[model samples]
Target: MDLSSVKEALAEKSFDKIADVCDNLMLQVASKGTAFHDDWPYAIHLLGYFYVDDCDSARFLWKTIPSSIKEKKPEVVAAWKIGQKLWTHDYAGVHGAIHGYDWSQEAKDLVAAFSDLYTKRMFQLLLSAYSTITIPELALFLGMTEDDATTYVVEKGWTVDATSQMVTVKKQAVKREQKVDSSKLQRLTEYVFHLEH
Candidate 1:
């Protein structure tokens, strides 16, 4: 297995190619039983899964990795911690966890990728849950400044109420029939008839 090629792919952010390479390497390891004792393949696989937001598979890989290998490669464990936080919707924790450690270049790249993905997911969830939200609240949730958050909401086609400092998502318009009071109509007709006579 060309581990260096896998590393290169990861550094370049070629996630699909990394997945393919990891799958092939996993198969070879399954058939041949550990060609090399180093855990780079497993670490790379974990990172690939994290990049794709496959938290469950990444956790599975983490669980299966040998204790010695995990100790030797603490970066993998740190990456998994971020993935765990991400899976549980602890976006703040994810950010804090990533910054709490000095990770390898590959791990840092993975963190950056996950941060982008997490921000998108958070924005989607916020939009779904609230038709109108204050700019400050949205900014805090997305870790953005209020101005940037307002801009983002406006860019997504949601209306921003500058006076109220709120972002509003217009719900789909519903057509409703105007109801007429029959008794009021009858009285009005009678009054009109009397006046005409």
Candidate 2:
């Protein structure tokens, strides 16, 4: 595997392909007679999983990492801490882990993208799950300060009660775009007809 290509992808902030690159690297290393190398870029690999919201893969990767590498490379351990916080549903901890780490320039873009992706996902979850929630709780869930959270919710059209400090969630109707592949549907239909016969 070429480390330069991976570095290029990271420099370009091509997060969507990072996980696939790491997956390919893992398969290559796992091949018979293949030996582990010190320059595997495990930290980027782990962060790539988080970027794709694939915690299970991240957990598996963390387990396969050599203890010596984990001890020696603080960045890999730091990336895993983000995965741990995510796995445990510790929203506050997730924010803290992301902000606390001094990430390398290559990993910075993906890390910031993960934080934005997580915050957006949490906001969507809250919109559907809660009719009303407290300011502090909302702040914690959204990984923002109370003031910032309040301002964000207001911008989203949520109403905040000053006296109670409770925010009323404004649910937006999501238009799910359904694009049917006609050829695929036709093939499936033909297969079902043949099976019925």
Q: Which candidate is the best by lDDT?
A: 2
Candidate 2 runs further than 4 Å off: 174-197
lDDT of 1 by residue, 137-189 (tens): 78766767788878877787889888998889655457999899999999999
lDDT of 1: 0.74
Model 2: which residue pairs collide? none
lDDT of 2 by residue, 51-146 (tens): 888999999989999999998989999999999999999988999999999999878889899899989989988998999999999999998999
Note the Cα lDDT for every prediction shown: 0.74, 0.90
RMSD of each: 9.7, 8.4
| 10 residues in a row with least lDDT, candidate 2 | 25-34
